[model samples]
Target: MAMRRTRILFMGLALLVLACGSTSGGGDDAMASGGSPGKALYNMNCTLCHGRDGKAGLNGAKDLTTSTLTKSEMVAIVQNGKGAMAAYKQLLTPKEIEAVVDHVRTLGRKK
Candidate 1:
């Protein structure tokens, strides 16, 4: 239970940072630009809820490591979100979304 609370608190703080950091002259973190962009983006934006390995399942997040969703299906879910997950359609570009989905697919293959 405490772990869940800690996760929630962390997510809240991350969101706070995102909100405060946004400005009219917006720019993404360097992680969004190059070198394992998917993993980097996921680390910064998703680990709190979906987790580094995509099994945290916090706030109704699904276990990506075990998800049966196809790439397109997962892309839709990420772009639109569900339940407590925030829609990334506005936050992430289409290519980044695809990259994240590709990374998610790898999670299911890990032993």
Candidate 2:
């Protein structure tokens, strides 16, 4: 029974490590295609309304999956705010906003 318990603990630890290893860590992939900081930021600020996949539309949030807004357009909207959405200019830096825009672009590519 003790040996079985030890094996179970080892398996749990292995799973935990594997899970952590799979995370993106906000690297270049996140910057280029919404992997890390961009994904993290989106989750923190946009997910509540945009949904995990950017299609939730809670409180009139637009469906990012089908959005055709260009990067510059997205950046402007993010900085200036749309109808219901509040401007993020006060919250995120220019680089952060660009990262989020990059991330939002990835949402449309999801199958």
Candidate 3:
């Protein structure tokens, strides 16, 4: 039974490592971190320039309020980047990019 127990322990440790490795991908981080996917991602990545409330307006960061870009357009801009904006395609997954787009939509809301 000693060998059997060792094998089981090894398998459990392997599974634990695998789970921990994949957890950093943001699937669970999104839920546990609080805030929506976009809000979390934006806070981590975009808030420096765009501002926390989305209106600090640093370095000519275009007021998201005035942006004419639709959600899809905004996603493209984020993925591809504009004049001064750097593209985030490499830093974030497509799902994370979509989360940012959805979060931007909520800017300027009353609540």
Instruction: Tell me which of candidates 1 and 3 scores higher on TM-score.
Output: 1
**lDDT (Cα, tens digit) per residue for candidate 2, span 1-111:** 995565356445544543553573534343444344566666666776899889999999999999988899999998888998878776677887897888898889945
Candidate 1: tens digits of C-alpha lDDT, residues 32-53: 3333456655776788799988
Q: How high is the lDDT of residue 8 in model 1?
A: 62
Ranking by TM-score: 2, 1, 3
lDDT of 3 at 19: 55
lDDT of each: 0.73, 0.73, 0.69
Ranking by lDDT: 2, 1, 3
Candidate 3 residue-wise lDDT, 1-111, digit = tens: 995565356445544544554656655445433546566667656776788767877876888865777789999999998876767776667887898777877775534
The alpha-carbon RMSD values of the candidates against the true structure, listed in the order shown, are 7.8, 12.7, 13.3
- What local lDDT does model 3 show for residue 15? 44
TM-score for each candidate, following the candidate numbering? 0.67, 0.68, 0.64
| Residue 80 displacement in candidate 1 (angstroms) | 0.7
Model 2 TM-score, all chains together: 0.68
Model 3 pairs whose backbones collide: 38-99
